[model samples]
Target: MRSRPVLVYDGDCAFCSSCVAFVERRIRPRCDTTPWQFADLAALGVVQQRAAYEVLWVTPDGRVRGGAQAVARLLLNAGGVWAVPGALLTLPPLRWIAHGLYRLVADHRDRMPGGTPACALPAARPPGPPGGS
Candidate 1:
């Protein structure tokens, strides 16, 4: 139960759960995953809107990464064949390509029988203006 980086995932997604299970069992020194809803992203100083849409990796220092780079970072931390791809994805020229591929997969996750994947959380209703205006 050592404190480490946190992985935010969609708990309702079967694929996401499987991925988290992979990390929990395969990654030595095991990082923890928090359901996107329970982690208190804002309290953790994470930008909830940005992180909720895709995979996120929050390092111990509080920095965050999204898209394929996030997956690569986790892989890098996991220490194995993963490191090779992680190193490749982080390369500047290739980084955008990596993100693009990630976006494509994310865009159609539900079609894969992965679960009822849906885009975007519900819109937040802005609080009533100052003084109940």
Candidate 2:
């Protein structure tokens, strides 16, 4: 088990790095932040493909949240005025919107400010039916 929660991001993506830096400087969530490439993913209960696809929030007890959910967790952990929006993000309707927006941004991160060609993610695979391959 980890002593602290960890926020895992892609180090090679300049846009992702910049976003993490902003969170550290502005949001100041009470957690350790690390690039997935440098983190012990197995210990964090994160898989490589998921880490490659989205930012992750790993709890001390080993629960892992990814993508927009990770962002919501970060905000909720920060507490204070930020908590409202964070909590809202976890709710329905808004949750769906947040997920959609997150996917949009992630899919085009290479075009985002501070992004480099390295920020371009690999094409994502379509989801299979539940309990089926």
Best by TM-score: 2
TM-score of 2: 0.93
**What lDDT tens digits, residue by residue, belong to model 1 across residues 7-50?**
78767667666767777876642466787877788755566555
Clashes of each: 0, 0
TM-score of each: 0.76, 0.93
Candidate 1: stretches off by over 4 Å: 27-29, 117-133
Sequence-dependent TM-score of model 1:
0.76
Tens digits of per-residue lDDT, candidate 2, 78-132, equal 9999889999999999999999999999989999999899999886543334564
Ten contiguous residues with the weakest lDDT in model 1: 119-128
